[model samples]
Target: MNMMSYAIVSVKNNSDKLNALLMGMKGVVGCDLFAVSYDDIYTVVSNVKGANLIADKINALTFAGVIDTLAQQFTLLPVRFGSLMGSADAIVKMLERNRHEILQNLLKVENKYEFGLKVFCDSGKLMEELRLKSGAGEKMHLKPSPEIKNSVYRDYLDKKLAEHRLEESMLAYVDAVITEIAGRLEHLGAVNNFKKMVSEALIIDAVFLLERDKKAELIQVVKDLQRQNAGLRFILTGPWPPYNFVDLDIK
Candidate 1:
């Protein structure tokens, strides 16, 4: 039978404990589960036949839920969906090949948890506000007046200038938000990675790796931020295994 593999959960060199954890747990679509190990790291896997390999939203969510459940019990590196190996022996050899790097990554995230923060805003509304704010500033010098014969050139320049100013304003607004978040997290001593303008509506896509005990504090921080910025929506997902923080790419 084909196998559907998930990730390598850390066991601290105890295979029996890892096996026991996998015993009753279900994987994507309630498949039968088993494990493949290399020293302290174990990849929990399940059987997948012909029709099961096709990607489905429910299957993906179920797989993620499985990983989340396992993460509550042990340190693990969540493998990307559809990651598979031939057999238990193949997984063991793969782990053995990438042992040092895997351990290093495991140690990096040992007792920490990961949180994803996605900040959304009404782009059209926000941009309109930004344009009004920018317009209030000093106007740029116009070399050629719009009333002149080459008014088309002037119009083009004006449009381009407005576009540039809008981009700058958006970036500035994003920076201010990031700065506020950083300041709050600094007080809590959290480590974070942030990306701005991931999508038009999603202005900030960020992840934080923090002590598991500080989950409540982090949630409060996000709530406070949302309260302070009524125009933006903060959607926080996780307490996850450090999927975003893992720094290794095993060959």
Candidate 2:
């Protein structure tokens, strides 16, 4: 029998507690869940026939659901969705090999919540605004004599220049936003990772791991940022399972 790993929990003298928790929950494909422990660390996993398991979204969500329920009662390093081993012994051996790293990750995420913030915009409107600004710049720089407006090459160059300037402006704007968010989260002592310009509709995708008790304050701070950043919509989600903060390698 194979085992699908859900999370690496800091069981730390609490295996019985984790066991009872798993009894009331389900794992991928609604399989009964169990734990493989080594000292203070536990990997929550479920029995699955190697041939029967389908690594699809449904199973992934089922795996995540189990992790979610486990997270409510423990601080865990959420294993990647499709992680599987040939047996419970394999998981234990893997844990024994990577024990130090896993324990360190668990300690890092203890009592911390992971929050996601996405910054989105309507690209068309933003482009028009940039065009108007660039047009204003062109007029100020042109000679006093009225220049011909219809040179095809010049028009193309001007458009390209405007696009370049617009991108630079957007990048600068994103930098300022990142600075602002960092300043706001400084007090919370959050560890964050950010990706800018993920897509036109999704300009910024960021996640922060911070003290769990500050959830309300984090929301308020983001609300404040939303009000300050005009034309950009911010969506904040989670207290999640330290999904983005777990930094570990199973050696």
Write candidate 1's Cα lDDT for 57-143 as tens digits: 988888888888888888888889888666778888888999999888888887889999999999999999998887756265445
Q: Where does model 2 exceed 4 Å of error?
A: 141-150
Q: Which candidate achieves the best TM-score against the true structure?
A: 2
Which regions of candidate 1 deviate over 4 angstroms?
140-149
Which residue pairs in candidate 1 collide?
none
Q: Give the TM-score of candidate 1.
A: 0.90
Every model's TM-score? 0.90, 0.91
Report the lDDT tens digits of candidate 2 across residue range 122-171: 87787677667677776676433246556776677666766788888777
lDDT, residue 233, candidate 1: 99
RMSD of each: 2.3, 2.6
